[model samples]
Target: MDSGKARATPSFSAVRTKRAFEAVTDQIRTQLANGLLRQGDRLPAERELAEQFGLSRNTVREGLRALEVAGLVELKKGATGGAFIRRGQAEVVVSSFSDLYRLGAIRAEHLTEGRLIVGTAVTRLACQRATLEDIDLLQENVDDSAGSDAQTALSVNLDFHRLLARATSNPVLIVLTDALIGVQRELLKIYEPASQIDVIASRRRLLTHLRSRDEVAAVSEMEQHLRLLQSHYLEEDFRYRRRVAAEAKAAGEAASDEA
Candidate 1:
C-alpha cells in the first residue's frame, strides 16, 4: 500500500499513561488534524483499537463516545457499522447558541445587536459579490414572503437573511448567520413579530440596492431596518415581562383572598 494510504490504519502506539483513553483520543485527533483520516473514513474495530492502544475495549469505547459528543465522529451499529469521521456541521454552533440563550447567558439585546452587525456586513459583501442569480433568488424570497400568514412570513423573512449570507460566498459568515438566526428563532417564540409589510418593503429596497451593486446604500438600508427591528423587539420584550408580572400579581391576590 502507498505510504499515504497506509497512514489511515490504526497505527497508534501503545499508551503507557494511566489516562489511556485521553491518549487514544489524542492520537485520533492528531490523525484527523494531519488529514490522515477524513470524513467517511471508519476506524478499525473496537477490538483492533484496544489492541493497538494497549488498552481495554471499554477504554477505547470511552474515547469514541467522547469523540461523538465533540462532533468529531459518528458511531453506528450493526453490520457495516463503526466510528466514522464526520464532516463539520453548523448545527453544533447553532445548538451551543441556543443553549446559551436558554440558560439566560445570551439576552435579546445581544442577539438583536449581533444580528445588526452581521446583517450589515453580509449585505455589504453580498452587494459586492452577488451574482445575478443571487439577486433573483432574493427577489423571489421577498415575493414569497408577501401576502403570507404571519407564521409563514416569519419563516420566509428569516430565510431571506440566510440567502443574503449565502450570497457573500463566505462560509464563516454563513455559519455565524445560521447560529444567530437559530437563536433568534428561539427568542421570537417569546415575543410578537413586528409589521410584516414594513419588513417586506425594506427587503424590496435592499434588493434594489443589491441589484445596483451599491454597497453603501445596501449596508445603510440593512442597518436601518435592523435598528427598527431591534426597537420593536425590545418594546415587545418589555410588554411580555410586564404581562407576566401582572399575571403573577393577580394570581397572588387571588390566593391571598382565598386564604
Candidate 2:
C-alpha cells in the first residue's frame, strides 16, 4: 500500500474483465476480416461460445449483442434462428451514423474536421504505399464522382478514401477510415448536389497529388480541400439553422406582444 516507487502495479483483474469482452469481440472480428466468417456464416450457439471462452452463456450473449449492434452479426428467429454475419455491413455504419446525427452527438463540423485530419493522413500514406492498381482505383472513384448526385458522389469519394487507407496496407488505418467516412456520408445528406465541374476538379487535384507521391503536398491539399468544404457546406448549415431559430423566436415574441 506504499505510495512510493516500490509498490506493485495494481492487479489487472478489472482490466482483464474488460479485455475478456474485447477478446470476444476481437475473435469474431478477426474471423470476419480474415474471410473465415463470411456473410451469412452462422455463429456457434451461445452455449458453444461460452464454453470455448470459459465464460457464462450470458456473457457470450452480451458479446453477441455487441457484435449485432456493430453490424457484424444478425439474429433471426423461427426455423432458421441464430446469429448470422452480414455480407455487406454498410447499413450498420449508416445506422450508427443516423443514431449519432439524430442525438446531435455528431455534428456536420465534426464530420468535416474528421475528414480533414483522416483524409489528409490517408492521402499521405497512399503516397508512400499505393500500388499502380490502387492509384487506378482511386482515380476511377474520383471519376465516378464527376457525374453523380451529391449522395452518390459522396459514396464514391469515400470509396477513394477507403481505398487509400487500404493501400497503406494497415488494417487499423482502414477501419479508422471506414468509421470517419461513415460519418461523412451522413453529413453529405444535407448538402445540395455537387456541381459536375467542381467534383471533377477536386478529383483531378486529388489524383495529381497522389501521382506526385509528395506526402506533404498531398496532405496539405487534402486539408485545404476539406476546409473549403466545411466552409461551403457545414458552415452554411450552422448559419441556416441559426437564422431559422432567430426568425421563429421573433415571430413568437411579436405574437405574444399583440395578444
Candidate 3:
C-alpha cells in the first residue's frame, strides 16, 4: 500500500503534459462551433479520424466519448446511429439549471431577480435599436403564444425574450440573457403550470411601448412583468412549505396518539 501511494503521486505529475486525445477533442470542438461540423453531420470514421488527427484510434475514441459527455455529440450503438451533433441544446441548458436547483445552489428568487434586471436593461436597448424585423420576430412569438398550451407558451415567451436580447447587439448580453431565461422557464413550469398571467396581453403591452420608442415605459413594463412572475414563484414556495409543515404536525400528532 505504501509503495502504491508513492508511485501514484509521481505518476500523476509525470503525465502533466497535454494529452493527445484532448488535443483532438479541442480540434473537433472548434470545428463544431465553426459550422464545419453541424447537427446531424456524421464525423469521419474512427479509423479515418485517427489518421487525420495523427492520433491512435483509442485517442479518437476517447475524444468522442468526451464530446458525448458534454452533450455536444451523440454516440449511437446501432449501425444507423454514429456520432451526430446534438440539436436543440436549449433542453440541455435547461437540464443543467435543474441540477443546480436540485442541489439548492440556485433558487427561483435569484433567477427572478436576474430576469428583472436583465429584462429591464435589455428592454431599454431594444426600445432604442429595434428594427422592423425585430418587431416582427417578437410579434411572431406573441402570435404563437396566443391560445397555446403552457409548454408552447413558455417556449414562445423564451423566444420573445431572446429576440429582445438580440436587439441589444451585444453577444455577451445575449448569452447571459439566454441562461437567465432558461432558469426562468424552469421556474415557471414548476411553480405556475396553469397560473393565469395574461401572458399575451402583457407581451403585447411591452412591445407596444418599445415600438413607440419609449425606453422609460419599456423598462417599467418589463420590471412589472418580471415582478408578477416572481410573485407566482414566491407564493408557490410559501404554499409548499406550509403544506409540508402541516403534514409534519399531523404526523407528530398521530405518533403521540399511538404512543
Candidate 4:
C-alpha cells in the first residue's frame, strides 16, 4: 500500500474540527458591527488574536487580510503597527462590486439598471439639497473633464458622481450608490479610452442642468446620459455573445467529425 493510503483517512470528527480562515474573519466582522470595535480603535496584537481564537498565526493573518480588503480594518507599520478600524469606506465597497463584474458574475444590464435607479434618485435629491459649495464642486469636475485625457476623464466623471451623491447629504444613499457606480466604472476599463468624447459631453450637460437647478431637467439629463453609456456596453455584450455562439457551433462540428 502507498504510505499515504496506509495512513488511512483522518477521522471524520478530526476533519470536522478543522479551522477555517473565513470563520475567523466573520468573528472580527461581528465585533466591528456590534460596536465592540470603533473606528480608529486598534485591534489586539496578531499573536493575541491567534491565541484567543485557538488558531495559528496564519489563520489570524488571513482574517486580518479579509477585513483589510473589506475596508473594515487598516494595518499600518512603523512604531505602531496593528489593525485599526476605518471610517466610511464607499470606495472599497465599490471596488468589491467591480471585482465581481470582472469575474463574470455580473452583466452589463445589471449595471445599467442600477445606474438608472441610483442616478435618478441622487440627481433629484441633489437638485433639492445641493448647496452652493456642492454646485461649485460639480463645476470644478466639469472643468477638470474638459482638459483630461480619456482615462483621466473617466476618473473625473466618476468623481463627479460621487460628489453629487454626497451633495444629497444622505450617507447611506451615497455609500450604496457609489457601490453600484463603482461596478460600472470597473467595467469601463475596456471602453474608457474610446469614450472620451461621450464623457466630455455628458459631464458638460450634467453640470449645466445642475447649475440651472432644474430638477426635472437634471433628472432627465442623467437618465439620457446613462442610456448613452449603456448603449456602448450593450453593443459590446451583443458582439461577445455572437462570438461565443459561433465558437460553440464550430466546436460541436469538430466533435462530430472526431466521432
Candidate 5:
C-alpha cells in the first residue's frame, strides 16, 4: 500500500472463534433463547457446569459472570442459591437501550418521541382494559412517589407507566415501555438535582382518567405529561448551547487580541 493512502481492498474474513468462557455462555444463552430453560430455572452447580463443558471451574465462573451481567442469570450464595435464569427481562432491554444511547446510535429526542407514542398506547389500553387491581397498584405507586426524593420518584413514575403497559396484557408492550422508561430514568439522574416538578398532581390526574375508563382523556393526559418531560431535556439543550456560545466567544476574543 502507498504511504498515507487507503488500501484498494480490505481483507474480509471471519473473526476468531469464541473463547472457552464465551462458548460456555453461548450454550446457556441458547437454551434460554430456545425456552429450554425457563425463568427461575437453576443451572447445574459450577463444578458440574465445568465438568459438563470440559472447562475449568474458573472458566465456568467467567461464563456465569457474563450471563449475570447480560441479565440472563442470577447467582446467589448459600445452599439454596445457585445460578437461576433471570425472572425479569426489563433490565436486559434497559441495558440494550442504554448502550445505544451511550454509543450515539440513538438520541434523546428519538427516545422521547418513542415514549410519547408507546406511552400513549399503554395509557389508552390501561384506560380501556385495566382491572381494578391494576388501578389500585398504580394508585400505590403514585402515592409512594409523592414524598420521595428525585431518584425514587423517577422509579415510581416508571413503575406507574409499566403498570399501564401491563394493563394492556401485551408482553411486547411491556418490554418496549421498560426500555424507554429505563433510559428516561437514567437521563433524569443527570438533572435530578434541579428537578422540582411536582409529579403527584399530574399522576393523580392520569389515574383518575384511567379509573374512569376514559380513553381519550387518558391519552390526552399522557401527552400532556410527556410534554412536561420534554421541558427538562429542552432546558438541558439551552444550557449546553449557552455554554458553547460563551466558550466560542472567549476563543474569538483571544484570537483577535493575539492578532
Candidate 6:
C-alpha cells in the first residue's frame, strides 16, 4: 500500500430531495472534518457529484456555491477549473463582523470595547514576542504618521495596530485584529477624524515600552490610547447627531416660510 497516496475525490453518499443542497454541503463538510478531503483537493465534476449524491446538477452547484460563500471552497473557471478546497482566510471573519455592524447587531460601543480588550492583549504579547525587525517596522509606521494629513494619519495608525498584531506571531490573533479593525474602519467613516488626539505621541510611548519588553506598561498605554479614541468617537457622534437635527429643523422652517 502507498502510504503517501492522496485521495483523488471524496466519496459522497446519496441525499434525499428535501433540502438536498444542504445535505450535499453537510456531506462535504463531514468529509472535510474526517480528513477524507484536504485543502487544494479538487472535487469531482458537477455531473459526477450529482450522480453520487443522487441529485440534479443544479442542486450540486447550489451546494458548491454555498460552500464558496462560506469560504470553504474556491470555484475556479476554465477547463482546469473545478471546486477546490481552499485555505481559510481572514477576510471571511472580517466580512462577517462588518455584516453584523451593518445590521445593527454590533454597535459602536461594542466595537470600542472589543478593541480595548483585543488591543491590550495584543500589546502585551507583542512586548514579549516582538523581534528587533518587528519593532523597527512599528517605529517606521509611527514615524510615517508624523506630520501626515488627517486621512494619511488614520491609515498609518491603523497599520501600526496591524504590525503590532503580527508581532504576536499568532495567526488567530492576527485574524481577529483584522476583523475588529475592519469594522472599526467602517464606523470611523460616520464621524470626523481624531484630529484632537495626539496619536503619534502615544504610539511613540508605546513603542518605547515595547522595545524595553515592558508588557505592563505597553498594555496600559494601549488601553489608555483606546479609551481616549473611544471618547473622541462618542463626542463626535453626538455632535454629528445634533448637527443633523439642526439641519433638518432649518430645512423644515425654510419650507414653511416658502409656503
State each model's CA lDDT, in order: 0.90, 0.73, 0.75, 0.77, 0.78, 0.89
TM-score between model 2 and native:
0.65
lDDT (Cα, tens digit) per residue for candidate 2, span 1-259: 1233452221111113655767677778877666556676687777767777777777777878888888788888877788888666456665676678768898877777777887777778888999989989988787677767766776676687788888998766777678777776666665553455665676688778788787887787778777777777666677778988999999999999999
- Position 38, candidate 1: lDDT: 77
Best-matching candidate per lDDT: 1
Query: Cα deviation in Å at residue 212, candidate 5?
Result: 2.9
RMSD of 1: 3.0
Error of 6 at 256 (Å): 9.5
lDDT of 6 at 43: 89
C-alpha RMSD by candidate, in order: 3.0, 9.7, 10.2, 11.1, 12.0, 3.1
Reference-based lDDT, residue 238, model 1: 83
Q: lDDT tens digits, residues 1-259, model 3?
A: 1222222111001112259777766777767665566676677677777777776788779989998877888888777767777764554555676668677788877777777888888999989998989998988888888868877877777788999999888766687788787776666655654343566778899989978998998898888888887787778877877888999999999999999
Residue 170's lDDT within candidate 6 is: 90
lDDT tens string, model 6, 66-153? Answer: 9999999999999999999887688889999999999989877888888898999999999999999999999998877886777888
Against the hidden reference, what TM-scores do the models get? Answer: 0.87, 0.65, 0.65, 0.74, 0.70, 0.88
What is the alpha-carbon lDDT of model 1 when measured against the actual structure? Answer: 0.90
Better of 4 and 5 by TM-score: 4
lDDT of candidate 1 over 114-146, digit per residue (tens): 999999999989999999999999999999999
Counting clashing residue pairs in each candidate, in order, gives: 0, 0, 0, 0, 0, 0
- Report the poorest 10 consecutive residues by lDDT, candidate 6: 1-10
For model 4, the superposed segments whose C-alpha errors exceed 4 Å read: 1-17, 20-23, 54-58, 149-151, 192-205, 243-259
**Comparing 2 and 5 on lDDT, the stronger one:** 5
After best superposition, candidate 1 residue 119: deviation in angstroms? 1.0
* Residue 107, candidate 3: C-alpha displacement in angstroms: 0.9
- lDDT winner between 4 and 5, please give it: 5
- lDDT string for model 5 (224-257, tens) is 8887777667677567658889999999999999
Summing lDDT over every window of 10 consecutive residues in candidate 4, give the lowest-scoring window.
7-16
